[model samples]
Target: MSVATLSLFRFASLRSRLWVIGQMALARRSAAWAGSARFVKLCGSGSGVGFTPQPNWSVWAIFAVWPDEARAREHIDRHPVFARWRSHAIEDWTIFLSPVSARGSWGGVNPLIDPSAERASRTAGPIAALTRATVRPQFALAFWRRVPDISKVIGSDPKVLFKIGIGEVPLLHQVTFSVWPDAESMAAFARQMGPHARAMQAVRDEGWFSEELYARFRVLGTAGAWGDKDPLADALAGAAAAGRRDAA
Candidate 1:
């Protein structure tokens, strides 16, 4: 089965028009490149809803689909655009990749974001980092545009390591869920010339999306699965699972 890679980012210092501009340039270019590789189907960003203050900023979503984990790993390991851009841009990068086991609409299901709900999401757990923190009833498509489709004509062949599902949550904003060999490998990529790093700089420089970003990485157990493999469902389920201190 194909897996999903979800990532969310929160930038403490990302609150300026200049940063937004820089992010745009990077996103347009990155989208063009990834589009050529046939890895990304949709890419966009926006602000928070139903939540207060919103995050300083968030990387709304960076989602893609791949054939498998090995392919996804290889493509990420040897992407030219990523290698070239990592030199001057990007800093303080962190990422999370969760294989989605489910999918569903968060517009009405979330408790914290809903006006009439009991706020069930407020309950805390051990794996707090792996659960939903911020809640958005409806996602705002604030910064979005096209970079054209010249990559396919150029014949830039690229493959994916895993299939990805995009999710939107208030706390874990700008999330990307992916399956990697281990947390160590995921951490290494974050430290090296990874797409997350490149995109971070791009967003900071050109302001690709409307919000800032914050990410976390977690390993899945046999019982760990996203609800209906939906990104939003996966986030909620993951959050709940992370706090399961009694699981065997």
Candidate 2:
């Protein structure tokens, strides 16, 4: 099937009940079309990442990949969810979507933890080479917190390739959007010291990620201009623009 990627970086103050209703309306419409044969599988998922004192003022990055833009647009236009946004359309929130040509993995390493940067650097080399060969449109983000550091433990063991994308909704929860080079890599990674698994075990053994939450997604599509915008948008846009510049 032909595939097109769509990513939306949106902001909302969870304090407003209308936002919740709009989401409900949209879901209802999608459910209505469930029986249609023209329907194609949509890999839709996203998460939020930010801090807002009020539950109402939260930002979320939502993304999904569709078979094509036409289907994506059709879903949005005829969906009951659009009605909920009539009064608040583009007011409290904004959406940006772009079509993805390909997808891949990139990762960041720390100088402090990897004081030698040997293991960190060495680990990335093979993984990067494999990802380049198998995946396209690669990107990575750096985190100053202990989370990523602790997370990398999983990537290094058993020659695991670390592929992590993180997102969130306001102050609620953080979602992890990740893609491995292949099913084998993912299976192997899962069997070893992957951070999420380690962290979960740590928490169960003790109490950890005490206040943090994470979700994972199999990316669908990505679109829109990045920078001076959402971080994820910027990354995807940067990757796309880079692809164009490379071809030129």
Q: Rate the local accuracy (lDDT) of all candidates.
A: 0.33, 0.32
- Tell me the tens digit of each residue's lDDT in model 2 across 1-248: 32222233233445444464455335434554463212211111222112111232222222333344566555544444333433343332123222122233212211012122122121110121111111111111111222334334433444432223233221223333333333456556657636655654543354322233222222333333333433344334544666588789
Model 1 TM-score (2 dp):
0.32
Q: Please, what is the TM-score per model?
A: 0.32, 0.36
Highest TM-score: which candidate? 2
User: Could you give me the TM-score of model 2 versus the true structure?
Assistant: 0.36
- What lDDT tens digits, residue by residue, belong to model 1 across residues 1-248? 23223322223344533454355456545545553333342222333221222332433333433444454445444555333322222321212233322222222232112223222322331111222222222323321122222212112212212222233333333333333333444444446534534644553465444343232323322211232232334444554666585564
Q: What is every candidate's alpha-carbon RMSD to the true fold?
A: 18.0, 14.1
* C-alpha lDDT (0 to 100) for residue 28 of candidate 1: 46
Q: Best by lDDT, which number?
A: 1
